[model samples]
Target chain A: MPSLPDMATPEAERLAQEAAQPADPHITDVALKPALFDWLCRMGDGALILGHRTSEWCGHGPALEEDIALANTALDLIGHAALWLELAAEVEAQGRTADDLAYLRDAMRFRNPQIVELPNGDIGRTLMREFLYDAWHYEMLLKLRDSSSPRVAEIAAKAGKEVAYQLDRASDLVIRLGDGTEESHARMQAALDHLWPYTGELFTDDAVDEAVAEAGIAPRASELQGPWDATLREVMGEATLTVPDRRADVHLGGKQGRHTEHLGYILAEMQFLQRAYPGAEW
Target chain B: MVTDTLPSTDTIRNWLGEVPDPEIPVISVTDLGIVRDISWQGDTLVVAVTPTYSGCPATAFINMEIEAKLRDKGIEDFRIERRLSPPWTSDWLTPEAREKLRAYGIAPPIDGTAPDGRTAARAARLAGRSNLAVDCPRCGSTDTEKVSQHGSTPCKAAYRCRDCLEPFDYFKCI
Candidate 1:
């Protein structure tokens, strides 16, 4: 049968043929594939880490509605994580799968930005963190949709719609909590201040970013800050929460594989089953 | 010995129609629009399926069931392909699926397209309620309210009807 021209192909088959089609086959750089692989890990790591953090609230949400909503959000992020890591594995051209990368790697190898790995302090902080992350996440996906790399663009299209829904919810809740009663308002403001330092790492671009952006595989990490700021400005203004003006470069090194101690604790819990029993499957 | 002629594409679709969605048992995978395409690749059968949402955990199980059903139908040469582009959409749900959802006490998605875009979503935030006016699946009253933007599953949102005081799941648009 003829290939279905309308249907999207698998990532592996596409990547295998990616270099042959000369239109914009940047994967031929051989040197660039590792950088692309690292960049993909950053995308996957953040989603997986934040998804794990959000899922900690599975049965513990402040309210039933919030509980169910947070769990759903966690599921969506995990799903995105799986997709990104799957692509990352394919690019590594190594014999590893997404599961192996997720369950086998040590914390030192993880490449998620620092903000996501921080503890979910409280309901206010959790919501505040999600809102902050969602704003940045949405902005990046919007730009990734235009990536010259087909795999990046395809996953972006698939994940973009869901992130929009997530951002919408997170921003709405942040506004209500930030502008509500005095107690809630104070708590939200506190959460913002605590989380503000972490947000700086999200835009700290480096060599991996430069390689991917030059290859047209992904955008520079710093490019996303502009749109992220626009969203935070509009949403924070409405929420009556003030953006911390201290600094935007207070934290960095997450994308470069330097992570906080929290990631190790997270991995112990997250990877216990797979670590204890190698290649375990249900 | 097998015959040279394979089952028609329509016949394969009919067999797939027997597979119920794991979460929403009332609807078949076809009804939910997860099965995107079916065709023969030489002697092998190719089935393209898209997950309703990227993170839905049920996708692997659903794929297994599809494989099992096809195998049970005596089709040994087959492969499942995942389609992501022209990504899955709720608008693809069959009209009959909407009816079945209503009968099952889950509100059909508001006759809405794709995701409610940012502008409409922001408007709902401003209005302090959902933009879509969802009718009660049970009481059939228009006076209903959204309880949460998400629900027990990624594909659903939670809502409640004022007249019936009944909480239900709304098949989320996109």
Candidate 2:
């Protein structure tokens, strides 16, 4: 087998090559800078992958009310994804539609953070993951509502309301599960412990985020950290849960298209119908 | 009264007012304030619409129904434009439509001093806990409790009234 460093070099080179090329050759608009376009895709891809995971619980939730709630949340995320991806397609100036970006891309091309692509282990784990993400998503949307790009601003303004509700639902559920029976409390704590390391990736800033921030299209990912921490601390405090200590070696690189094993399975299931029957529409 | 020229914008708007909402049959599209604007672009008529919520599944159906209704009226050259800014809210529901929702056994959203209090409340709810008072349509009592945030449809919430002991869907302020 090749050495770990040798494997890393080729992947890094491939990513560099991919970055140099425009997502679509047909895109001729110089105004839509490549960095900003990538940032938009990152936002949309995160929502799409996470939304797909949430939708898996459609008929299998612990309770009837929860089943409906999860489905509703999934729909909201998917809707937000459509808006962002549609904008991304416009920025690319290609004939590619939102569905093209969503269903056609391979796992290696997705820009979603690794945290969202992780398997939904259980209700406790799922809500914990969602709470972490929704808090950051809500804060980011709050800032994006004033984005310099009119399209981004419009999409953010509409999606902000939906994300707020998602944050509320997830926060409430985390508190309920954390403060409930002994078994539930232990499970919730364990879920948080398992997922805590992934939380750091949500606030990791890179060139794409910096470019988008400079252009006033989105707030820097680092700027969201303080508010995210405050919200998590408050919610966790109320739930009688402790914030796990940050690990020094947090997994990264999902923004650069490197993902966990789970993404392939998700793509396989989500893209099956679309790939099998191209141009299939209802 | 018939003429070779197409009907005026006012006439088309009036005809659209007769098209009932697919989900809430009691309210017309115009009454629900989903129809934002109507204008003529060359020979084709354009109707601007905004969905009540971003992810509302009813939007496509509403668009299709609007097109079919206009086509049925012998006006085939029409297009629907979706407007996202000035987003749709429950406040847009006309007073007449509010009454109709109540009569249909669904609680109408509360009118507030703020233009879109529900949207505002959602932001507030994230910061802390905020609750909106939804009066029961049956007993007209203020004693009601939210059972679940998710309801039969995306636009409604499940609520139960204490006095009437009946569960009803509240057209939640969005």
Candidate 3:
């Protein structure tokens, strides 16, 4: 079956023309200063660490299809990490490459949220954590798509689609397991409770977030609260899972480079190749 | 700056067009809408490219292929500039290219511009509604179900036609 050729709309043509311009003034003036670089590192680290954790399931997923899905999701996250870290390196201007930033940094120097660094306890826990994180990530990327830094905006634009798909998949699983059977529902609920405290850290704004927000590089983490809450509530409702109490004490400090105990082990494993053989190339 | 020894931009573009996409062999890089811009700086030729998917593993290979093709054409002092702004969209796939993809048994993307003509498919993706109905390439049936959101490559998704019961890849809306 032959398909019709996609005709370029006038708007698309205009966008194409705009892209062809020698240089965008908005892009030329946007430099990855210290604050922006820090913000980018936080974003990149979250993806990298979570991607590493998810990759642990590559061959062990419950089913063949799930194995492929998890691997693909891991690849997407790592890909986003590469973009963010590459930009961070460019801003640092210390001759650091994406790999350098990814592999050379110790656990204490990493800035991913506490939630992503935790162990993937079970399929229930894993999907619950992913669902929560993906929701925030999807909302965050939507705002980032309009960042003053054209590079961030572009990366967000490309990565947002992948995150959306992940969110959909995770949400589906959450609903399925939450409403499936008594044991399954109980397991998912328990996972939700276990992962809930870590989510508060995702929205706690700090100096780095403030600076980036001021510089138009990213939105304030606090700004994502409403959307994140609404999404969580809606998905949980469909899944027949109870929403955890919000007043519970929140976990914090991952953004400030202090991570949970799990992060150190993750770093040790992930950076082993580079640390053992510096400058190793595939 | 024009130099007597250098080929024209048109000549360079045509030569680059001959380089096929490493993954989708039936289509050229240009057909895939990856070769965004070609320019000259001093004596060096700059080819700007955007990856179809940010995490696409084929990006490095694609760049290598382009470099090899240019070198084979006896062009030296060239650099491949990776452009992120105006990130690649399936909408950029030219009409001719879409037809070629369909002919190759991979369904091309739907017209990203819906009836309102403003909402491009990428926007739909950002809104988390990417599973747009895709017709089967073999039986031309709209009744198809997505078997998996992923396929052999990052750019495509797996689907099976309800009518034909044939599994195929849908060049995903992204």
lDDT of each: 0.84, 0.78, 0.79
Best candidate per DockQ, number?
1
| Model 1 alpha-carbon miss at residue B171, Å | 0.4
Superposed model 2: Cα runs more than 4 Å off: A1-32, B1-6, B112-131
lDDT of 1 by residue, A30-75 (tens): 7788898889899999999999999999899999999989998998
Candidate 1 C-alpha lDDT tens digits along B5-83: 8899999999999999999999999999989899986897878788888888778678778888988999977777777
RMSD of each: 4.7, 9.0, 7.5
**Candidate 2 C-alpha lDDT tens digits along A142-177:** 888787776777778788877876777688778878
Candidate 2 chain B weakest lDDT stretch, 10 residues: B113-122
In model 2, what is the error at residue A114, expressed in angstroms? 1.1
Among the numbered candidates, top lDDT falls to 1
Which pairs clash in model 1? none
DockQ (Cα-based) for each candidate: 0.37, 0.24, 0.21
